[model samples]
Target: MWRCPLGLLLLLLLTGHVALGAQKGRGRRELAPGLHLRGIRDAGGRYCQEQDLCCRGRADDCALPYLGTICYCDLFCNRTVSDCCPDFWDFCLGVPPPFPPIQGCMHGGRIYPVLGTYWDNCNRWWQAGNHSAFWGMTLDEGIRYRLGTIRPSSSVMNMHEIYTVLNPGEVLPTAFEASEKWPNLIHEPLDQGNCAGSWAFSTAAVASDRVSIHSLGHMTPILSPQNLLSCNTHHQQGCRGGRLDGAWWFLRRRGVVSDHCYPFSGRERDKAGPAPPCMMHSRATGRGKRQATARCPNGHVNNNNIYQVTPAYRLGSNDTEIMKELMENGPVQALMEVHEDFFLYKGGIYSHTPVNLGRPERYRRHGTHSVKITGWGEETRPDGRKLKYWTAANSWGPAWGERGHFRIVRGVNECDIESFVLGVWGRVGMEDMGHH
Candidate 1:
């Protein structure tokens, strides 16, 4: 009796769910055109029996009790559904006068004429919860939360022209990893949590690595990002986000103490409840806890141990030039644009891919992010095409991408990674502290 559009009616007939749609007139509550009501239960009663719902081998949220699962087909159970659900093809695939269910025709609540990709356990679980909508976040929210935080004046975009020397046939090594050369110098990846403090973290981390490498393992200090996040508020906002150049400027003037002295909570003043006054005289000094006071960099005349970064410069646009900078210095800070698909990246070199969200304009939503460029390598494809990638260290923790690091398409500046690269020199005079 319900008049569905011609397309829906045809789809229902083709899928053999026409009988299900026809049950709407018989006192059956019609959720959607083809969706029918099997039964209903009391408010507190179980929605769907344990054995009734789809398990799909792994005990994920599919088994959870949902109001829809109790009465509707398991194919339409949770708020989101697709062919990935268990027994989807067995019972719900072309229901009456069953026809051979098309394999790979549907996935994660989406229908594809051809099988470009299929759903798996990881994608199913990730898609169910971790998206812009599920987290109550929109592209605007992400842009405001991440990219909008940094002040416009702090952008070092035009610094690229400083190092435009062409590396003509420099004959470089096959692959290079900064950590391999500077063992124990590059610190492990740190997590920034929900805050947008990647700017501060990447700056602080780059400074730490450069200092250790520059001093030839003499001044191997894990500089404190908390110092930059909590104390450096001149032209930047903590947590809410700030520019990396401002952080580097803060480092150049008001050196950061060791993490042992002032640990990093990763949150800035906004999210970290309240900001504590910069500690002047702390027991933990640069030279262990024994020293009463260590020399603050640039003669800050402050009590806390201070470190300074030399004036930051830009890196070349080409991979060869960037590699040369990495070999000479240490890790450099890079700001890149992040797309929606980037969140689901598990491993391998990442490239921007279109997400089929029933909308063509969804790709416009992007957020700016920062990372440390540590190394580079090349991988040959089966078709003889070469995929060169830049090794980037992210602040999202090691469990994220390739152990807290990800490789992006190199040379082409995928996601504008090669667009803005900045490097700084560590302050000298920390070689042999007490051994000399």
Candidate 2:
């Protein structure tokens, strides 16, 4: 038998296995250069580095925030990409990832190889190494697809507009108040000092309230995360950054909020205990502080904001049932959805310094600038002093998480909320909701 060059033979084998795998599925390029070539990805969505030797290129999950690398061209990569990109949802929205019909590597540094890559069944140009742009956008596209596709019911009101137009002396409902029923009580732990997760506090309070309303009757209000974080709402001028207490007031005025439209800043994270008074010169003073939390419930971004709210019992209904349930439980925790592109700021509150969004000069964190209802409020370090704040949680995981799990401010801060809080609004669920 003729002896072939060992290196050459290995390359062919790696290439062959890559091909076989893709063919097995629809078409997935192997993630990278290989040894076994069948390496598995881990919790961080990465495979072991010991298995392959890939050609150098602009890696999606590479340097800095990238943490590690993936062989963009490994077997079945095309298949994986197909399964993820231009998904059913993306197809509906005008913005879909390029796949199958347009196969090819578009590496950051202009390196599109002819031999190492091939566009598979979907007609994509995939290579032996990974093409993160394809992978990353796939998830985003999927989400966008969902947003673009989910047919909105005529009854549902646009949350963004509602948050902006809310006025003081308004009333809505809690599940219990709406149904004119009593609510159950379920106390949870507090997460003291943890910053980024404050949303959880607000969310939990809301959810618990909902469950209580659904389970029992009208209940008392819980603490507010926005108040605790020194970030609350002022007017709908967008990200004016006020105290958390205002969140409840904002919600009372408006039934919901559109977290997708507005962008926020952590410019004053360290200024503790309610953000400075609104910059909206000559603003009218609002009423009592009962505490609160608001929900964005869309997009994959983690951002914080201040808000205001007025106190009132309410019961809410509609697509916002989830938010409504939580809101009725009293002030709860909430979290802006976490995204891969952006990180949450915990080192301080939203004052003095602007939360770093990676780019120094730009100073603006990009992405949907949207929001989500990720996790709930968890109280950590509640031992009176040491670790005496509430923690929040999100679907995004630890890295994007600031504080501990997550956190939100409480009490006085709930007065000037920016977004709308969902719940039974002074017998709202029982109310006509104007039309629906």
Candidate 3:
């Protein structure tokens, strides 16, 4: 046997498998002692695809094939094993397991636990084939512990329950509506060079959405594009990104002035000229404690794509049915494509995949065409595993484009982008576009 830490070993024995220590430094990965895996498969559908081996097949090899239902006992097939049902976020939000197995997990956002606990010991299915891993806490246990509740499909929505706790009469629609302090709505693409205020950008967008919806009963004129190009660069501690919530706070207090008044009178070369270092005056800078980069905000559902973040709060409950009812519906101020990541398939920059339709469908014609909704789904998995995912439509391109559509995890992986909503990032108090 190999040497293990202190309490970890005990927890492993009591549970079932040995939990591999995530290494920070560089060195060879040593397998845990007595870690017996069962039916593990590799990218070739025979054995485990050693990291050394897969690296060679990088560009060519997508990933391993499906390792059908594994009846656990060790780590995920070729991997090691664990005892306790590891934290859901730990695995889902963080790193994932090996190839083939992970491929399925990625598709459905089913972040399985390390060597499962006793009942449905996640460990038992360590190397099993094709079956969704049934690891970690059971449905009943979670409710008892007050951690989460089971939705219609068996998948657990911990945050949803917490969010709904205070509101007794809260309906599904209530939870998705715009919040207070919206100002910067950005359905269009604004060059970052034109602005550096990511906080201002998103805040304006939310404000625009709130104003339009509240006044006109639907989303009004599309907001400007130039927004949130610097908050993440200067004040925040990350790549030039922004958080919608933080933007909201700034809009409420500091209040963003119009670019017309501030005029980005920069040279052609210097598009977004750097202003004095960002001075976060509002106690509620961008998102939270202003670090360096743009992070996500609270109540957000996904971020992997754009369609998933489509402006649903603006539409009434029967909006879809009504739209279906009336074939005469025409273009509005904007169109939302709610994919896993909140991206607008604008031309020039993000046009990796142009509209496949030979005819340009007039997305750029009137003031109405702006957003589009792609992926959207519930919070459960097919195997009845407790999962939290983002449902969005994807246009991965004609290559892997499934009927010009795609869906992915909402919170974990790249999908966690719920913070891009109108109230969350756009502006409030603008003209409304009548919907209902």
Best of the candidates, TM-score:
1
On the 0 to 100 scale, the lDDT of residue 279 in model 2 is 21
> lDDT per residue, candidate 3, 21-114, as tens digits?
3323212232233112432222111122222222221121212212221212222222333211122112322333232121111111122222
Please give the range of 10 consecutive residues that has the lowest summed lDDT in model 1.
Answer: 36-45
Error of 1 at 33 (Å): 25
The lDDT, on a scale of 0 to 1, for candidate 1 is 0.57
What lDDT score belongs to each candidate, Candidate 1 first? 0.57, 0.27, 0.25
- Provide the clashing-pair count of each candidate structure: 1, 166, 115
Q: How high a TM-score does candidate 3 get?
A: 0.28
Say which prediction, candidate 1 or candidate 2, comes out ahead on lDDT: 1
- Superposing every Cα of model 2 onto the true structure, what RMSD results? 20.1
TM-score of each: 0.64, 0.25, 0.28
> How well does candidate 3 match the true structure, expressed as C-alpha RMSD?
20.0
Q: Which pairs of residues have clashing backbones in candidate 1?
A: 255-307
Q: Which model, 1 or 3, shows the larger lDDT?
A: 1
95, model 2: CA deviation in Å?
19
